[model samples]
Target: MHAIVLYTSKYGSTKDYAGWIAEEIGCEVRETKKTCIEDLAPYDTIILGGGLYAEVIAGASLLVKNAAALKGKKVAIFSTGITPLSYREYYDTLVLEKNFKDGIPEGFKVFNFMGKMILDELSLPHRTAIKALKKLMSGKKNPTEMEKLLIELCDADGDFTDKDAIKPLLDYIRN
Candidate 1:
């Protein structure tokens, strides 16, 4: 099957995953910024990757916006975020709700992967945003469970990208 990987990344995590997926599938990979949905029509399968920022999947709206053109193609989406993988509710419900408002396409599959967050690598704006978010969440005298998790995630650092962690996604796409 002809396949292509398209992605948008910040801090390079999403791009890294997109590259690995393309390599594993032996297909081409392109950044969404340089490619349009119309350009992808010839491919039977498409894998879209993006980084999760403030619960939003960066650039994923393009896929939804162009869904009419992408209908009937095999679609897969993956998100790279600092959120821990164990938080299925946050990823599956919260994140999905933020990313796919009309719902994912019928044959599409979604995957989430752990991504890196280096405080130093973050731009001043992003760093300030995270700090402000943390402060807001910290002000809650009786923080909810999710608020506590957010506070902890604010301090997350280091790379969590594991090549082995991508096996399941690769297997699904290969099938």
Candidate 2:
């Protein structure tokens, strides 16, 4: 099957995942900025990767907005973020609700991967936002479980990407 992996990464994690997925599947990889819906016409499978920001997947509107055009293709969308996989509620509920307001389309599959969040590598605005979020959550007298997790995530400062994490996605694509 003809396939392509397209991604939009604010940091490098999503792009890295896209490359790894492409390498494993023997498909073409391109940044979303360089690709458009028309470019997707030739591929039977389209995998899109993006970094999560405020629960939104970067550049995902490319697919969400063009869902009708991609009706028959196999579509997989992945997000890279610092949230731990143990937080099933965060990933399975909050993220899905915010990203897919209209509900997930029939042929689309979603995945989430642990991503890097080195404080030193973050852009100024991101760093400031993290600091602000940490401060806000820290000041809460009785923070909710999710807020507590956010506070801890603010201090996360390393690459959490695992090459092996791509296996499930690969299995889905292959079979």
Candidate 3:
């Protein structure tokens, strides 16, 4: 299939998944910033992984913006986040809508995986933003289910990357 894994990780979780996917698929792995659309022209199957922050995915614009140029290619986008896959409604609805405002491209599929959010390893700015978001959400007298999840996620501190999570994506690519 000539697939390649490209990732944009803020704290390594996305990169970890990309490495695992590449190893299993026996394809090349690279960071999105270090690559360009033209470099991917030869690859028919493209796997793009990125960390999720503030409801937005890091470095996914490259794939989304170049969807036109990728005509006929099979594109898979995986988002790594702390919100847990159990919250399918959030990923299937909220995240999908936010990231694909124009509509998902043809032959494109999206996947969500558990990601790390070690409190101590976070950067100063990211930590501060999390704290502020936590405070803001905590103040809501009647927060929605999504808001409550975000508040809880802000305090999450552990590695949630699972190698098994790559199976479905790999299977899809193989088929």
Candidate 4:
């Protein structure tokens, strides 16, 4: 299959996954910022990988915004975040709803993977945002389960990127 993997990564987690995916699939890998929708027209399969920040998938707008341009192609998106996988409902529901406001297009699929969030490596703004988020969540006298998860995730600091996580994405494109 003529496929290309596009990724936008801030801390290399998404880039790592994209690199692994490209290596396994034997396709070209390019950063989303360096590539455009027109550049992707030559490929039969298109894969997008992005880091998740406050439910928004970084650089995914290229795919969502240009959905019409990529019509009839095999499309798949993978999102990376520090949020734990036990919150499947949150990922499948809230995340999906926010990301795919219109709807998941035909011939498209979405995947989620654990991402790294090293406290020391975060930018000044990201570190501030995480602290603010944690404070806000901590203020709730009895936070909901989701809020609790958010609070816990804000404190997460480590590398959770795994090469095996790309298998589902690989199988989708090959099949």
Candidate maximizing lDDT: 2
Candidates 2 and 3, the one with greater lDDT: 2
Clashing residue pairs, candidate 2? none
Against the reference, the lDDT scores of all candidates come to: 0.89, 0.93, 0.92, 0.92
Tell me model 3's lDDT, rounded to 2 decimals: 0.92
105: Cα error in model 3, Å: 0.4
Instruction: Put down candidate 3 lDDT per residue, 82-150, tens digits, no spaces.
Output: 998888888878888888889999989998999999999999999999999999999999999889998
For 1-175, candidate 1 gives per-residue lDDT tens digits of 8999999997999999999889989999999889876898799898888899989887777777788888788888888999999999999899988888898867688889999999999999999999999999999999999999999999999899887888888888778
Give the residue spans of candidate 3 off by over 4 A.
none
Pairwise lDDT winner, candidates 1 and 2: 2
Q: Model 4 over residues 101-137: C-alpha lDDT tens digits?
A: 9988887899999999999999999999999999999
Candidate 4 runs further than 4 Å off: none
How many pairs of residues collide in each model? 0, 0, 0, 0
Q: What TM-score goes with each of the models?
A: 0.96, 0.97, 0.97, 0.97
TM-score result, candidate 2: 0.97
Which stretches of model 2 miss by more than 4 angstroms? none
Winner on lDDT between 1 and 4 is 4
